[model samples]
Target: MKRQIITFATLIAVVMGVGFSGCTKLTDFEDTNVNPYASTIPVTQNLLTGALRWLPATVNSDVGAIYAQHIGEVQYTDASRFLGINFAYDDFYRGPLLNLQKIIDFNSNPETAPTVVGGGSNANQLAVARILKAYFFFHITNRWGDVPYSEALQQSDNLTPKFDRQQDIYTDLFKELKEAVDQFDSGAPVEGDIFLNGNPDRWKKFANSLRLIMALRLSKADPATGKVEFMDAKSDGVIMTDAESFRYQHLAETANQNAWYARYLTRFDFAISEPFLDYLKSVNDPRIPALADKPTDGNANYVGMKFGLANTTGIGNNSISYIGSGLREQDSPELIISAAHVLFTLAEGEARGWNAAGTPDQVAAAQYYVEGIRESMKQFGTYDATSFAAYIAQPEVAYTPADAIRKISYQRWIALYLNGYEAWMEWRRTGFPILDPGPSPLSIDGEIPRRQAYTTLERDLNLGNYNAVLQSQGPDEVNTRIWIDKP
Candidate 1:
């Protein structure tokens, strides 16, 4: 599949006369299907469509879900046990990032900009490209740390790019997102925006919301900067309603259906983790039924599978709860950033005494906290006035001044369910919910991995840059914490 994508990308490069050298030639497809009379001019809309399609992998990562302890392995357990490392990020660069770069370059060039105007206004297209580029880079840096930044996607000009410091990458990302939002003009909205449907207002809100969340990620490493950025983004505007959430809506067709639906068709390798389910059950979370299904053991119980267990002698589909049917449906939407996430960040900001509306107080923090939870419940279709009120009234769920950060972090984790990468990052940042590595842990030093190792391709192909990063950013191991994950 990856080879096919690279082939398609190479074809695009050939047609457009852009020398994209990010991907290696895996196979010769010269004899394969080729339209000799096809248009040589690049279409920005098609490139944008390809870019958007690659985004689901960023949010739908099974390994990330495992790391967050949101799901457990019912059969194969290597990922849960933290066995895999050195995951490749080439596909991201060779695919979506490359496409986005093309969009920006084509729109920026005066000669080509007019040709691609059918895709959208040149300004709008460039703005969307920049915004998405930042978004993808944000995830990539969070996952791998110290990745290629300034010199990345230079086509044939610089194949072996230098790995920038995570701090610098983040700084530039904030600038990029803010600029992208501000770059939008009163022109036609961007074409092929499957996520926001070419809605500039929603795009602005999404960009600001992402900036807000990224600001919060700097809480530990640089709290002063975090607070300033958080307030600025909040004041600018953000996702404040469920309708404005950033999501990737899947189709009911086999080609673009929900990934979970395809996974469950023949495999039953994942189940709700015992730790996560127990926490939900303990707090009487109304989203429990919405998160998992009852076991088919004839007892009709929502039994969660113990995570990272080496000895899964008897566990099967009949014994543990599967993910909820709604979430696994063919057309189920995959949420990227939501109002609940932004609200939770605001709650945290308030707790930290960073506020734009007014001086922060426990009262405002509590109010934001409750609203965050309410928004999350509503997001999951489990909100009811009585149940919500009762749920928040619980001693564990209720907001208190002393436990404000912890309470807010816990609820945020709940709200971030299924978004494993974000959830894991939050856990690393806040040290909330106190996740314990299970008995049979297999990661470096038997600890939960903090970051993934650089791919072997990096060491072999980009050897100098790879070695330099290892010297500056600690060893290329899962335990090497990223800059933002500082203690």
Candidate 2:
């Protein structure tokens, strides 16, 4: 198999460049004409493979993990302390989004459609591209709130595209996902789908599962819409088994190995956060050993580092627990979405009175809650019938109708483990299992950040659009809440 290899260094360079540069505009006649040396037509399969390579996954050392308090720095603690705020979304647009756009454009155009059939049937390719585009946009909008959307990727047609409201972006996302699922034809399935092995049925399940998850995000902002979308997606069918979970399997080769594996090769800066470990230990969670490694202090202790400390100079490298070895293997798989996540979402939906049928709301919610935990335990390789039964029998783990949401949220947080960004987003939305900043907090207002600040490139290159978004979305600060994040 020919895999597209994208290194972290290359991604960093792409992100550092100006945003909107992903689109190309021909300013000169020479540029407008295709060069004989270059292939004007893109191979749709290659494009799809390239785009999939850019899909984001949770990495323990990333700041998202720190914000979620999943992992903390054992050495430099700047990220956990919130010293860095501005983040770039350009690499996403430049890499995956651009490739996906090209696939859509090619398959949609009559001239190019026939040529790319080898990759898949025109309708199938377009369906996959649209679904992926929606998924990528969902991630983007969630992080920075209002971002370039409707008029984006216009190449030279519009360099300074206006930022769309997060609400509108989400509305379109739901529509796009639904439409994309409908667009799939009983034709050749997409050939370069590394996530689902080009299975159209699996793709449908993925799209519906994503919609189910996205619908729940509007619980606070738009319950009516949320319930409708959630039920509709549930009716459409979602990932019901662990085998159907959306995962990205990495090869042992350096070109496409796990990012965490690469980081651990020569560095040991990240360790499990004290709060997370302490919580897991307090609840006697069975997944603890599978989640972290015992410290190297010649003892069997699984110590974690205090999150967001100002100075970790005194912390010994061997004193803190590293990420579990099972997770950092070169060929370890990374999850995009899991059955456990879907089960937890179902639990929340039931608790919120969005249950379609089955047992009563509380009863169904409890069933889903327990199953969700089981799925998560199975996912992390910690499931044992006896231990699981004992674990759930505990008073704290037992589900209570009044405290259902809080309980579900805590389990969801644990289930989301390494998926730091999603976990952090859920925390912002639900405020469960409350997280506190370290003693030496540096974020705006000394509170956890609600959103990432716009990158400096946006301010410098797209000043007009940047300023306009700030006016409507509130000041470009870490503390400002996005539209869906209602207080």
All candidates' TM-scores?
Answer: 0.93, 0.92
Residues 1-487, candidate 2, lDDT per residue (tens digit)?
0012244765665684455355574243345435679766668999899989876443332778888888998888889899888998887777788889989999999998888898999999998999999998898888899999988876556767889999999999999999999999989988888877888888899999999999999988898898899999999999866777788899999988988888789999888899999999989999999999999888687898898888888789988899899988999998888999999999999988886662349888888899999989999999999999999999999999989889999999898887888889899999987899889989978988899998787888788988999999999999999987878
lDDT of 1 by residue, 262-312 (tens): 989888888989999999999999999999999887766699989989989
Q: Total clashing residue pairs per candidate?
A: 0, 0
Error of 1 at 207 (Å): 0.3
lDDT of 2 at 455: 78
lDDT value, residue 171 of candidate 1: 95
Task: Kindly report which residue stretches of model 2 are placed more than 4 angstroms away from their true locations once superposed.
Answer: 1-40, 57-61, 356-360
Candidate 1 error regions (>4 Å): 1-36, 356-360
TM-score of candidate 1 versus the correct structure, residues matched by position: 0.93
Q: Would you give me the overall lDDT of model 1?
A: 0.87
